[model samples]
Target: MLSKIRKNLRAFSFPLWIVAASFIGTIFLVWGKGSVSGPSGNEVATVNGEGITLTEFNREYQNTVTSLKKKLGDNFRKFVKEDDIKKITLNRLITRKLLLQLAEEEGLKVSDWAVAKYIEEIPAFQENGKFSLELYKKFLESRRMTPQTFEDMVREDLLIQKVLTAVNRAPSVSQFEIKELYRKVFGKRNFKYKLFLSKDFKPQVSQKEIEEFYKNNREIFKKGERESYYVLKFPKTKEGEERARKAYKLAKEGKFKELMEMKPQPLKDKELIEKVKEKGFSFRSQENGLELAFKLKEEQYKSLNEVRGEIERALREQKALEMAKKEAETFKGELNEETGKVDVSELVKKLKLLPTTNPEELLNAKVGKKLILPVEGGFAVLVPTTEPEVNEFEEDKLKRLKEFVLNVKRDSDYQNLLNLLRQKATIKVNQSLFRSVQ
Candidate 1:
């Protein structure tokens, strides 16, 4: 759980001290029993000679999965993969180890009194706005943790927090930078634009053009070899293997009804196309499970006649885009500079001309200047109708902008520090053991 919270703590936008204050109670639960250990063959990785055990990795990984499930709910699987979570968990562990090592080298120390004071401030261990020993003990007992163990984790977190604070001290912004940032944030400019879209300039495409395009870009029409298969995927364990063998026997005996009753998934495994011949089955081992694949469909590509309409439509769009660009270029050359306006009322009646604001370009463009810019799906001719101006001075707004600039600088510094540490450190990972971890 501390690993998960530390992941959030890395965001320098939020003050590290504030995060530590709020999450002090939950941080101790990260390594309940496996907080301390010696070197072992079960190590997943080592950072600067310090080994990260498998027990620590599994605990952190489970915590991350549980946290994400709660936050994302049913959409969890769509956004995150198990393998990615594992990799992230491992990286967090490595980074945490590095930060702690750096803290030690810098002579950072969290006294017992400091830990006690920090614990007293946590709301979870307080009753009626005061520290309660009874509540603290009860909290630890409920989680099956000793006071010493919890205090140790709190101290480590404090040390890391100190290192982060020292590295991310607020940077000083110059007066010129402040004025420039204020202008960029509050400045606005008025402009008039006329857009030319391919759909509006419909061009006729001949049959010969379609055939010629298809001939030149045959690979674009080529499709990947697809296969339909019935997969019986099970855990890579003894019992799972036994069930797979029985299912394979039923499949060979043509008892598809029984196989279907066993809940074999009717899926497509494109990667197994060449390995599994038609009307034959193959046993394959995956990272998380073993599968029996029964091939169903053969590989084939679509004929030219089947894609003729698609090719024709593509050619028409291409010709239309070319004509639209040509027309826009002509209008750009013949535009009236003094008036700096084009009648787009008729085009607006036909299609939406969404306004796009680019602050940098708007600030740079002089009054009455004309610019031909490329927009989504077309080109646009723009004329600056008004000059850019900054907002009126406000003390509160200026303070907030200064804080924002400092936060950005701190975030950059933190990342650079981590990158430098990684380059100078010797890190080794046990790939085979890591992959074999369930």
Candidate 2:
């Protein structure tokens, strides 16, 4: 009899459908707290005088976490914390209560048979590609819920869906809106341009000027406190260690580079430093010249000579951008619309050329006007050579746009309804409850 009862219980287990509505429906279920109590024992919150027990809150919280974990994988922790999850879970519970209360007020009903039919249609509760009563019962049994309890949940879920469906009906998209949207997304323009890069117009800087700039921006040359080391590696064998000792002697004689010639390998400084930290190597060991020459941690600012090349490059880029802007302004009016295309190629040879076949940035720009477009190193002088070409009307694209517009409208209305419900509902949460959960 016990085995038969277990089988029956296992057959009625709840699946994904039980929690699907909760996550999607409760996305924007944010609410403010109020002070109220109802002989509080395990109640985490209350919505419209209806108690949301800690048990229900925890169950829903776990379900939501599990779903998010599946969707976000390892990044789940990055986006959500325990406290945030708890708050959201409570909000969802409050929203669920509000919606259920609304359903009750409006006399929304879902028959037991209807709930049963919904369960039967679920693929997870099926066996051998067909719905099985035994499988359904077993599923419910595993969750420690009776068939009646699971059916009740399904009934509530169905009612919520009914309420949402009534509000979420798709709106019709006008032809004008679709056409406008199509134009915005699919518009393309051809640009003829000559780019002037910083490297091409690099201004010559004297040593005195570089020193003056460095003096003015001394803080930019400040280096972090660091420990410099002279690193050397040898094989683990006795002969290798003996050779390393010899090499250490050579290093003392300032032949560090010649010593490094014994083994030619690319030593990535950062990785080597990390490995040293992990292994807890001491300076006293002097193993394989690893601790042969080490400097005390000290703050050292970079000299003008060390960063002279970098500063020059920055100054040149600044000058180049300034010069390019002037050149583009001067060149803009010289070429007329008819001759612009022919002049572009000759101008490109003189400056850095950036010819975009269909430039999205200039989609709405006039064909004859020259634009000073910023590039990575400098700027470009561009003219839209061709008007944006709109493709022939596509039925599939129009249909998709209509559906997209409908969904957007539905979402907005649904959110507004939720906000209105919150105004009408009285919600109180126990702030202390979240501390224990974490």
Candidate 3:
């Protein structure tokens, strides 16, 4: 159950909040706070007068934290802050409330039998892959939740799912639409292109320019202090600890060759470099009784002379690219489409014209149209030589394309529906309570 919650939380995205809500289901059922006395007190937020209680918000926040902690381990704080997590949790709750209210307004109903079946199908309440009444009772009892409350939560979940499914139904696809999409995906065109290669253009670089570049971009030339260290890691056993101690003693005495015989690898952890700044021996312990030892090396950097050749090459490439773009633009300006006097075929032969496979630009380009398009290594002046032709249709490929188009339409429709609902609904949030969330 924890693993399932973690997986859903990790995969949660704001646009697909409805899908995440479906996975969350009645997990919050156990966290139910008994009847709200007033809208302003315990309720964290209200969706069209429906209160999302503080207890519910807290539980959701804790569940989100648990899921993230399990997934990210010790590095969880590095990725997300507490304030961000709180905002995500509250927004999710508000969205869920909005959808559920929308479901009620749309008259979406969930039957008692449907709710019962959903609860029965839950693996947590099952024994030996079959629904067990005894396990179900015990599970609810352990969570301090009654069967009535749990079943009601399940019914609400079912209604939300049903309404989302109804709203996101795939729209009808016309034959013309499919054919156009088919052409777009599988069409091919013959195009002639003259690529301006930067390597072919040699731009003169002066010694003064190289020196100025080196001075201006000193940070790029500057290398960080790097220290290499050998790590001797051993398992959690008694024998492992003894071996680690022996390895550490040898490492301190500069017996690296003897340490190499013990199979210690080079330590590459950046954190260790910060901890052990000086050249000496360092020891650490890891999970499950694992022991480790490190022997550090003095940090060093290279002189400017060592990287002068690299800097010169970079400057030359920069100037060459600029030259290539200008030359391509100049050639593009020379061609006259109306007069047809440019003899493109003769120029193609003389300049070694390359074939363009950029389908998007090619599809949009009409015959006799010339485009100055950017290409790898430089720019290219492209002209479509032939009209686009749809390739032979394969059933599998067309089916995939149809599905892709349908999904895009559905996603757009779903977002539009959510926007309309949000615009109509009166959502009131308790800012004080939300700020109090830790």
Candidate 2 on 1-438: residue-level lDDT in tens? 223222333343233244344446343445544554332667787777678787787778887788779988967979877667776777777777877776676566777677877888888898888899888888988877888777777788877765565555423568998877766456444556665666667566677877888999988989887644445565668876787677667655655456445653433467555654454222234444333332224467898889999988777667777876677667644433231322233434434445642344454567767777655666777776776556676889888887888889777766666677887777876666645664
Question: What TM-score does model 2 achieve against the real structure?
Answer: 0.61
List the global CA lDDT of all models.
0.67, 0.64, 0.67
Query: Model 1, clash count?
Result: 0
Model 2 CA deviation exceeding 4 Å by range: 1-22, 25-29, 32-39, 187-200, 203-391
TM-score of 3: 0.66
The residue pairs that clash in candidate 1, if any, are: none
Task: At residue 163, give the lDDT of candidate 3.
Answer: 55
Model 1: lDDT equals 0.67
Q: Looking at candidate 2, what is the lDDT of residue 361? A: 46
Tens-digit lDDT string for candidate 1 (117-180): 8899999989999999999999899867789978887887887777676555534688678777
- Candidate 2's error at 304, in angstroms? 8.2
User: Highest lDDT among the candidates is held by which one?
Assistant: 1
Candidate 3, 1-438: lDDT as tens digits: 223322433443222112553433221111123232325788887777788898788877877788779879967979888777776676667667767776676555677777777787888888888999999888888867789978877777776666556554535577678877776556655556667889989988888888887777777755665545666778878899899888878867876557767876777787775554565556778886554545544435455678778878988999998999899888844442321222333333444444553445545667878777666678777776665556477789778888888888766666565566666766677777777877
Q: How close is every model to the real structure, measured as TM-score? A: 0.60, 0.61, 0.66
